[model samples]
Target: MINKRINITQKNFLLFLYIVILGLFGPVVYWVSNHNTQLPFTGKAEKNPIQKRMSIGEKILVKANNDAAKQEGITAFAGGDYVLAIEKFQSALKRVRNDPETRIYLNNAIAATTESPFRIGVSVPIGGNLNVAQEILRGVAQSQDKINRNGGVGGKLMMVEIANDDNNPEVAQQVAQKFVRDQKILAVVGHNDSNASIAAAPIYQDGGLVMITPTSSAETLTAMGNHIFRATPSTRNLADTLANYAVNVAGSENVAMCVDSDSQVSVSFKENFTWAVYNYGGKIAPFDCDLAAADFSPEEIPSQAISLGADTLLLAPSVRKVKKALEIASDNDDRLTLLGNHSLNTYSTLKDGQNDVSGMVLSVPWYQKAIARNSFIVNAQEFWGGGVNWRTAMAYDATQTVSQAIASGAERQNLQQTLANPEFSTQGATSEISFLPSGDRNLQGGLVKIKPGKKSGTGYDFVPLNMDQIIEAAPKPSPKGATTNPRVKSK
Candidate 1:
């Protein structure tokens, strides 16, 4: 009985050992077969989690390095060390070429280095009451100095060089050619008169240089195919606004225009004024004056207005001329109401006319009183050490616009292409200025009516003109093919 029990126990123990061996070997065989099995779609092994995790970590590290490079580049750029900034940006690009921010800094550095530094070229009139031109240039110089102090466009110093065209079309053309050929300037800021600008347009177009006129308002300029730009509204719009305001708002029935015959800007103003006056149920009588005439008398203008039976007169001339015209108009008829252009909006002009300009109305894009209290304005003034003029503000806006375009990765050659972009809108100082495909600024208008006085309390009170009011009051267009005035060919 003892021998049989020992045999049974040994058999049971063998069975138990066999079961343990199968349990270990079964999983190994199944794993090998499963590893060899092809996936239905990919025919490859499933992705490795360990490898994917390593790749993600590497990507994050690269991103961190790129960010560090970008921050270093901006600091260098802001400090005006464009060379260092360029090197840093190029290194960053090697790691993150697809980054938009990296591309902007690279382009800006290229532009700053490639263009002439500390130099600006202007095509402006040489003589004939150059005070306005002088003031504009002075303002530009001040702005350049300020910008350089703060680390210029890309932290480089800037200088402006003025070129005189003597108000002669041929001279203007020659000067523009010289600016491009000899100077290789990147941009121009003048050729103040519309006639001068038109004459020089072809040269600037060929050179691919940008031009921003502070005063030119010819409608044709708005269509110049080059990178031409202007801060003032077009003459067509100005005339329409003035006439509409005169007849509709001021309640004038009879209007007369005293125009500067020798001035192209004046001729444009007169033609547009006539169309607006007649379209708004008002009559217009025209009087022409030689802008070059030294002994201009208010009596001469009054005689013309009296003959036309005009109760309202529009004077479109430079500030000096406007002041003289106002004096003549007031002397000729105290009952006469004066309507003027943007040239009359300055404190210098208003001060010259003092009580003479009491009731005259003018339109402007911005007013000092309106902006004086704003923090941005205050900061701008403090930055520049005083009140900033319209020209300075325009320059500021232009610089900001250019910087924003660069920041958005716009090519130096195609800066204008980014004018309509939302980034440009966000970068400007005063207003959100975006460009129409036509190269004109999309901006709003403001109106200020002059009241008599010297002190802050009585100098001028401005009423903001709503966009709807401006649109409704705009002058109607003349009938098709009806010429208000003969187109004067540029000399």
Candidate 2:
């Protein structure tokens, strides 16, 4: 009986041990089974809100197109092996020399491996407009490389974190918030579109962070806040430059305007151009066409303009309507003087239009040949393997502005105050940079005309149009209603 009772006691003890073991390990096993794809739930495994939105180190490589060397470099970077990261990034760059993002990563890795670095965030449309994004990034990367090579900002190297906003307003706001949350990021140089910049401006303003936009030029951005600054010339300035040239220099009296009604930038440019044209003793033609119209016919624009007694065609298409603008340019077939805003200053104008766009005058924010700083051009050529456009120039200027402000004071509030100061000024790729009370740059834009040239690599180039060239290209006075009946196919 004693042996039997002992056996029962042992069986009960074994059963209790099994229950305790199951209680402790069952949930873990279940969790492991359910979450096979995820890491174990440690506090370190949890991604922060910033990580969810923005890519960094190895994370960026995953999101972007990747190669073996770049992947290794990013892995090393994520693992805190800065030396390996730098070496691998350099190796990767040797294979793909024209990639701006890899160059930037290499520069950042170099900065990190060498010294303590100050960081800034650059938000761009990496997914939506990869080429444009790279152009902007080339400017930022060039500025960073130059600054680092020249002993950096008081011996602390500058590092940049790239954020892909994809030019979406919602994504831009998210990126802005992420940037504002990170205390290490001193300032931001970013947001390619006016709407994107506008969406993110309020967030940056509320957070007291300095946001310098390289390309956005909407008038609404002018008054967003003291913290928001624009490196590019205001829309009114660009429009006025084009209008003055059209009327006074080009001797155009009657201009037929093609506008994209769906785009704020287009409408704003047209309105400002109209005001400036009327003030300069020129009149807008009565017949106007909307580029954004669903049934808009580019082939008929030229014939209609001729019928309405227009001596010049002003294209105010948005970035989305560039193809339409180019189609109109082809349809015009050199019958009338062509003028466009900065929106049309794209490679498409040179490649797609070719001879069709010759002699077309465009208002641009900066021209490389016209800039006083030859060093910027030389360094850019060496760094990027080619010439860059106004976007690059303006982006470089924006980064220079922030670096100057950071030199005055690295703290966010102090830097904002420094940029807002009336005495603040810095020399940039575009010339001297100074801000008005409205946070708009006190600068004028340049005008360029497309011409056949061997240097452009596209059989055409945008030659800078000086005042003399503008006057020389002016057409002789012709009859107001002179119509050349070009063949038009009705849509």
Candidate 3:
């Protein structure tokens, strides 16, 4: 029923937008096709020409002729060729994620003894953060393709099944339960939000499954258990990096912050940034606005900062609010420097706000410019038809790390102990992958600034700004209530 015929490029771009608005929450969706769709399994031609469309989502492969394959497999089973029967049935279920009929045949055949495909479960907030989930799925799906094409991990074909949790804590718990029910699922690769990941952790921990997250960097998740790990840096490290940039690099004496009281990420960052700023001899403004209103007033932002004598303004709202704030800031003549958290590290911010976002600074574990310096960026861009964001990059790294673990002989039984080994390390697109004794991502992130450019899809790019740019002359201290209302024109 998908009448929308978008080209591959548009599909990729649209999915990127989905990632930015995920914080707002939405319904989860899955891409499904009919059971009778013709597959690569058989050569039979239909009497009627059926219109067909290719899915950009994961195509669960089906048997060319399920009936024929089942019969042949049965014949092979009767002939005592359990290996042949298992092979035939396994082929029947290659792209099929769940099929009880063939699953029994394949399991029976495996009992007779032979190599089998390794299955992994991928869980993400597909509905709530479709865009981020899409990018992460692409990384995982493409990695699965690459590994299978290159003889797979440990010589066993890699198979994956995807689940959508919509980023809800309860929904994530259900997804985790489903993953646990599927005994063949040796490991899991998801639960994007820190809350959802934390909610699902106990199930995975008790179920004896390996869980590796790509972008859930909340500070408390790693304490779940030995079975849990992540590819992105912890919130503590990310906040420290950004705080250093704000206090040491940006050299701001007074930091004013606007936070969303409803967002856990904002709250966590507020605490970290506050401590980091104070520790580095930078004082925070007395007036801190914790606004829960989504459609917050832009005029109030500058008014608060201008009146509080703040030299720099940090925003912890969603992208839409940030864009409005930027639009408002661009017209102001108060010489206020705008600062952002990792949430603003997205293509939509620059694409929608355009010139307004120029000079805006943010901190993330990975940036497109820094990633481009790595060799994997080229191939990833060529394959995905756009630049890979932090979500995609981290997801790719997570897959590579897990694949290496599997190749190095880590199994469901010992994967926890194996990943916990301090000696264990894997190379990634952005940097080396390793876990700490606390099971947190032992990583150091980079800081970036938006510079004028026409190269990126967003009409600007994130450039790695080091200490030199951070040490620029601090804006002259403005006396409280001294500046005239520069926003008079906008009003």
Candidate 4:
């Protein structure tokens, strides 16, 4: 009886061990059998995938049947085949419904068939961190329309590729790579964000592609290479301009700068501005100002400005912080002349805090003059549903610069050379825009003040100020026996 029980136990243990081993290796064996049945296994094939990938050569040669017309169009367009381009664009239009941009491209291509199309790529933050990307895109579209309407570049219709970079650095690099690969594309207008512009600039420089940043204002952006350019003034430029206004226009002997401590642009602006103020013989008031705190009293800057006897309160903070400080300053000091950089010259500023910044001073690259006469600006009211800002104006300028460069017969690699020429100037919306040897636009910018009864979309329109006008307006005695504007001498 004992021997029989021992044999049964041994058999059971062996069976259990076999089941456990099979359980551990079952899935692997089954996968190998099924996957290896179709193709010879070199142990490199992807398992459980829905489709197989083609080799590089095969992928390059193959064209999709679904997008055959679009592919052919792209090929023809890139190869200087305008007749084929027009045909393909028309075919694409018929197949792709609700695609306004495609229709616009087709119409422009049809209208300007004398010469081949000149393609320009545009990268904007369309998905993630879509801060004013739509507005920037509208500016680009307006430029495209105006350029196409004005007989196009070199009598060739302008075609544009609008890509979304999401304002992420990695994504912007991908966008730059795509632009480099497209042979038809000669120039790009994009990267409104400073970081994105900085990230993609190296790729553009290496690819020999011309990249024009519309609103990026980082100090080191143009230092990347000769192929990179910006239409907007840098933070240092804005800082210097603001410093001049603080001392000369606002007549501030002691200027208190309440800057955002966290932002690189703010730090750069503050450093450059401090030196500029010192050079102007103006005193710097030691104010304990912090703009990076998540929660703080709005009265921090105003109280410091008043305590230090600062005649001018220069605000360099986010828009929200600016509005908050504006309210506190306007209520605290009746004689204080609030000053800001280009960031404050916006419709939202007028709409949200007009009364607070009623007598505010701001220096910017574009203002009423550009807004009044440029065809793009004139029609912007109807197309964009409001007045245009500096971003829009600068973006439009960048596109126009590229168009003018191409229209003047600068082709392929010659475009950057022509743009770098000292005599090369393009009629921009704001003024004649030409690049410096360092790829920075040569501009001094302009100053503006908020005035009543001159309303636009937001609240009141900003009237441009001259040094003489501001000086003459200063020294006027107020009803409260206080000087709203202090006396100052202009150079």
Write out the backbone clash pairs for model 3. Answer: 18-131, 19-131, 19-132, 28-127, 41-64, 42-64, 61-95, 249-470
Candidate 2 lDDT score at position 356: 88
Q: TM-score: which candidate is best?
A: 2
- The TM-score of predicted model 1 comes to 0.63
lDDT on C-alpha atoms for all candidate structures: 0.59, 0.82, 0.68, 0.68
**Which is the leading candidate under lDDT?**
2
- Please rank every candidate by TM-score, starting with the best: 2, 3, 4, 1
Candidate 3 vs 4: which has more TM-score:
3
lDDT of 1 by residue, 380-467 (tens): 5554344444544554454444444544655445655565444456434456657656666665444667765434334643333453
lDDT of 2 at 222: 63
- Per-residue C-alpha lDDT of model 4 across residues 220-307, encoded as one tens digit per residue: 7899999999888777667766676777666789877776675445555666677667665577788766676666566555666778
lDDT of 4 at 214: 85
lDDT of 2 by residue, 133-228 (tens): 888888888888888888788888888888888778888987887788787888999888787899999999998889999988877786889899
Model 4 stretches astray by more than 4 angstroms: 1-116, 126-131, 294-296, 318-335, 370-377, 381-386, 467-491
Q: Global CA lDDT of candidate 2, please?
A: 0.82
Colliding residue pairs in candidate 2: none
**Deviating ranges (above 4 Å) for candidate 1:** 1-131, 138-159, 162-171, 182-184, 286-297, 318-320, 369-376, 383-389, 402-412, 420-429, 455-491
lDDT of 2 at 132: 73
Give the poorly placed runs of model 3, Cα more than 4 Å off: 1-115, 318-335, 368-374, 467-491
Total clashing pairs for each candidate:
2, 0, 8, 1
